[model samples]
Target: MEYRISEPFTKEKFAQLKAGDTVLLTGTVYTARDAAHKRMVEMLQEGGQLPFEIKNSVIYYVGPTPEKPGNPIGSAGPTTSYRMDAYAPVLLDLGETGMIGKGQRSQTVKEAVLRNGAVYFAAIGGAGALMAQRVESAEVIAFEDLGAEAVRKLSVKDFPVTVILDSKGGDLYSEGRAAYLESRE
Candidate 1:
């Protein structure tokens, strides 16, 4: 399942991904936390071009702390995903195929994913130190005044993530946890 992000995602690849499937997301991923998403959606509504192409892009909702010397980013992990739900449908319609964040997405977003053939992935919410190791490089792309909320271009290597919601109405977080709880009972 190791593949570069630039490659066209085949149905086979998508099929291989399920809830809790771990992946090393390499290639270019853009950081767009709350503020960045709001601004991006605003620009889209205004009919302005996005700073980066939305087609087949992967947006990671994160606001990493300032990195120490020789580090790519500090505690780089997913933030709550629901915050970006308002903007996700628009991005999905624009051809954005992948999203990485924590927590549940709104039902509207889930419906949009089903309609658009997109996938929602989640990284460990508090595992920042572990996550930082996977990110090899980072660069700011837009909204510099937003500080950590600025959109950043991240180059990651084998960055771990789990598929939370698949394109079809399958939700991993709920099902997976329920399965574990049921087994225990």
Candidate 2:
């Protein structure tokens, strides 16, 4: 079933999501890709505060393209999730509850998600142009020197995604493939 969920999801809200569920996420979400994650992780290691509060936050793994005239953002899409695996656990442990990206995550990230009551959602690949439409506002929140890889704070409405991994350790990538294969019999 499709759910309309707002950002800053609590543990109770996260408990309601499972792998393979469709979600239309609304409200603010932060964007960061490889470079930004590296910087943020490094900053944390040095005892610095993050640009935004990590608690109850949802972060999208994306590096949007340059915007055209009058648009809040450009083609915004999910980047491969594994690239952020090294940093995700730290954020999850810090109380982040949701993620939006594409591709499979490492076992460590999956474990972190389960342990921290977090969820991972996969946005459609190659749907950048369409996805950008959902972003109502965008501003660089940190690391502006990184250009397109800079961290961005975005306000989104009905941003689409599918739950790929849930807090209970459910994984759609493996289970969905097996289910599809079984259906062929």
Leading candidate by TM-score: 2
lDDT of 1: 0.84
Model 1 ranges with Cα > 4 A deviation: 1-12
lDDT of 1 by residue, 78-173 (tens): 999999998899998888888999998899999988887788989999998998898889999999999999999888877778888887778988
CA lDDT, candidate 1, residue 49: 91
List per-prediction Cα lDDT, in the order shown. Answer: 0.84, 0.93
- Cα lDDT tens digits for candidate 2, 1-185: 79998856787797889899999999999999999999899999999999999998999999999998899999999999999999999999999999899999999999999999999999999999999999999999899999999999999999999999999999999999999999999
Report the backbone clash tally of model 1.
Answer: 0
Counted clashes in each candidate structure: 0, 0
The RMSD of every model to the true structure, in order and in angstroms, is 2.2, 0.7
Q: Give TM per candidate.
A: 0.91, 0.98
Clash list (residue pairs), candidate 2? none
**Prediction 1 TM-score vs. true:** 0.91
